[model samples]
Target: MLLPVRHSSCVLSIQFRAHSRFATTRTITTLASSAFAEIISRSSSKHQIYQSISSDPFVNLSIEQYLLQKTPEDSNVLFLYVNRPCVVVGRNQNPWLETNLKALQKHDTDIPRSGSSVRNVLYVRRHSGGGSVFHDEGNLNYSVICPRDVFTRDRHAEMVARALQKIGAVNAMVNERHDIVLAQQPKEFAKQKDATGIEDPFEESTPQALKVSGSAFKLTRNRALHHGTCLLDSPNINNLGAFLRSPARPYIHAKGVSSVRSPVGNVSAGLVSSAEPFSMQRTILSIMDEFSRLYGSGHEVRDCASRLNMTKSEFNAGDDWVAGAVGEVQLHEIPEIQNTFEMMKSTDFKFLQTPEFTFSTFTTEEDPRLRPPLPSFLPPLTRISIRAKKGIILEASISTSNDEAIAQKQALHSSEILADRTLHEIDAQAWRQIIDSIVGIDYDGQQQQQQPMEEVVDHLTEFLCEKFGV
Candidate 1:
């Protein structure tokens, strides 16, 4: 048994011996058992273990420590989303063959910067009622992570992909978090996917045409479903879990057998051909954009799924409405932040976009009650902006009360209210009062005001009525 690393907590895991011709599934099972055994034996938290694994200079010690120290709260559940920039040879795939690492090195640096990349995995509070995801951020990177025991690995990735599917992805499959693939799928898959896009209804098909830009993933869409393309069989759960829970170096080697085809296979070319699909992120944006068009950009969230062709029951609601899935969180820009809590603090113009209303359902075919994981690492609740230029960043959050997770899933396949306000487009008067309150130094952001607060609301209402006119 491998001993626990210093400063790190025990993480249970499963691995797929992806790069072998004769490698039986049993071997991977053995590996998974060992990984889980190591985790269970540790009797410590994953946070403790992660600290042992990471030593980044940019992160805060306490927060970093908090991230590494796994609590006794939940079992180590490896919820993996393969969004890696270069191919990540599964604990078994040969890196050289699977990834053109040297080529990706340049774009790898170009990948967008986010706080969670410090360790390159999403983390979730144990049994925290949800999981976390490592996002691709539009780059071709694999999203991989481990969480406390709330769901299985097979189910975890499927849950993520399925949620992604809700957004209309025709080829999104949870090939293990560590399981990496070419930047693009095989040729046949590309041809089929492309042809379907051109022929299908404008709203029903994915907008992207398939091209081999090194590599990318396939998302399964509803059309693909109608044509009968499925994930076939679940991969070795133990192997998948371990891969998500552990970093590659110490656990998996770079070299492997030439035949290391992934059992955590992607959607086949055949599948992509039949299932013309919209990407989860893309679908959410389309709906949002349309909502914006109907109500004006950044209006309140309502009847999004109804706008689509699917029925309401198909929405696949998890435990709660996953606001984080929307990727819509926002933050205020720097100059706008007053240095001295002054009566009037202003410097520039700006806006913030919250998350998409729906993505994937994080539960497995078995445990749909379990919610999809949260974003790999929760960002500083919202983004900060300047007057249309560069600026410092800040955080903001949505109360659970304001976001009904289950209701959203139900609404996906049918018609229901997702949110009362999109929180993107508020009335100019509301903006004025918020600015005034901040300027007048009377109220704090998001907090209710006393007598003047009512006045603030009235002006905001009137301003929206007069200005935004929604």
Candidate 2:
């Protein structure tokens, strides 16, 4: 839609120029200049300016080139946030090993963010394998592109967190309006500084705090990732989105979470002493439960309402789903909502590298100058998209070898979420094949499945090795 408008404007301007060619040179120059100025001011509104300067196309552009060419004089700590608004895994993850490959792929983009964001896109991958989730603009995308020093672990991302806190505080204030104010009268902005300024003692005292800065410890009572862009000193001109759809952090949007929740709220302060991925805890339990029942024992994909007492229609799961190996064993059928489930295998893919690029600008009088008639590319900036989907795993494997041992191992390890057994319980072959598949070894493999159940890891990896020879 946007591309067409840009083209049409270009055509109209060209036609306007062609007609001007027949006029007197003085009149033609005057008209031409007017048109040029109008075009230069294409982004006439602040909102439009935000859209053009801070959305997808900018982020897609090479970060290095964008950074290098940024205006050196404008030194307010520039930040850019990029959110993948789809299903994103951790830095080290195995899609198959950690999630229901078939089910997750089909999980619909029921909720969407602004612009060209798509469903089921994997944005992050971690060493620990798990699941991907859905993310959108409502999730709060923030970035801080200041000097490299600003991003000092807790020091860097802290800015983004505090901003979210400020926003959340405002939201909370609105939620508790009657309490904040005894009557319905307005109160003045507080004398205290926001999260950042309060911590800075050296700065001179100020009665007013920037509205952008949020207050402290305003935890989101509801579930949802406080998301947005974060950039340091660099003028990070890019998309501010991060899909809040990791299994560790699932999208509660569908479950009706529309407010910001502090990251600290979801985590126990005691646990933060030796922080670990929170999703793995429950997810691992789910996996273990499934495996314990997977041996065709007492497993069945019973409706969720029958087990967890969840609202049947909550996940649209007519009933919340749970199963073991017995009556109704499930290998994860795609949900009916999003047809993409077929394409949405329990696949895990993410980009591991903090992709870097280079950009430069000089103060010379000639070309590539600080001021420009228009923001044109210099030497040109390029964008690179890196894809990743690998993870270290435990007690896993996959294979076409349906020997009794393999079947038994598969049954044993892949039981329902509570069947509970150690990885050592299964043999090396089953561990390698089934567990490996769960860990995402054969992710992009276009497996040759018949009409029904598809094969798992062992063969998929073999196929990939032969296809790419890596």
Candidate 3:
């Protein structure tokens, strides 16, 4: 369950840029112009790295896409960011089937002040092909964009695994699925045994590997983008299931990919030593170092560092790299980034992009699984079925257990009201009003039955709201 919490709604305006073993501070406008120019310029550095200061999911993702498209074709780029709490589904996945929209709504609220905007949780559809993922401040997102020829599914995943190992997580390894997982040592292997009889704890026979990172990819004719989420020290790990599990899943038969559930564990949980507290910053730095080792030129390294203030030694002890500037507010000034950001936040992109699916109150030919029983508050034989494409209702029908002709007519009217409407466009209040009008209609002047119908309508409205997240 997600609880309502207040968050800031301001956008960050400051920026910083770093060079080899030195730091230079610049204004937002200057940094955005230079950084934007450098990012898209083909003559720019071959190995580029960036760390996003903003926690906004929309802003961070928009920046990522911009880098994927605008960066030099042959350049190998690494972008690292942490987003505020959000559920991000794949490009073709259905949010209503992958996420608990009703629970997400509990965290939605408006905050008027401004400096850096914040929201408790958001629902996003990313431009990648994979299952849904949950992100928050505690999770670090790493993206590597390179030429298509050099791209391999396990390349960056292995890099991240090495970084995790460097930070004392020896159990971290890339699995055959190209995901980073922590191998669980069996109870028998936990104790010292005869050298001859000891079995490899991480052998293929072990069945309980806990996933710590999940990978997703997007490829173009020239560029390949690989990105993944690393669960470091998330406090909401236990609550992830509540957000990702959808009540509407059993009711919806969707066309796109569905998420594969895995037993997930935090990387911080399996650290070898507790002398130092786990930190996302440390994990990010380790990953950055690993990326640099793989792609950086021997002479020096450059990075678009966040706004955090740090000494030269804090960033790089040797004369290898320096931090620079780029802020979310400045990135928005770029036309391409602004357009992508707005599009990502729009309802059209969020819901209208969903693949075709059907929602039924009872099992149908297309969706043959037995459905959970409906609430007992309504008629036992009541049925509702809906078919949608690109989120628009193409067909709908509603019926009650009643055999009365008047009741049948009301059901038809209700169905007609729903047709052609987009699922996201209809709110709970709108559904209530539509249901009220049809149920309020005089049924052969039987005014005495209207009261009971009203009660039924109220229950039906609540049920629909929960099911559809209207």
lDDT of 3 by residue, 272-341 (tens): 6446777777787788778877876332333234333322111211122223333465454678888888
Please report, in order, the local distance difference test score of every candidate based on alpha carbons.
0.24, 0.23, 0.71
Q: Candidate 1 — which residues are off by over 4 angstroms?
A: 1-72, 75-151, 170-470
Q: Any runs in candidate 2 off by more than 4 Å, and if so which? A: 1-77, 80-84, 93-134, 154-470
lDDT of 3 at 270: 69
> 265 in model 3: Cα distance from truth in Å?
1.2
TM-score of 2: 0.27
Relative to the unseen true structure, what is the C-alpha lDDT of residue 79 in candidate 3, on a scale of 0 to 100? Answer: 81
Candidate 3's displacement at residue 441, Å, is 6.3
Instruction: Show the lowest summed lDDT stretch of 10 residues, model 1.
Output: 322-331
lDDT of 2 by residue, 1-470 (tens): 01112211111211123455473221101111112212212232001000112223113212211222231221111222234343344323333222323223334332232234345533333221222332333222222222232222233233333332232222211111111100111122221111111111222122222212111111112211111222111111122222231221121011111123111111111112233332322322332233223222222221211232111111101011111110000112212212222222222223112122111122222223342221222112111111211221222222232244444444343443112332212334544454454323223245543322333344433332221112
lDDT of 2: 0.23
Better by TM-score, candidate 2 or 1: 2
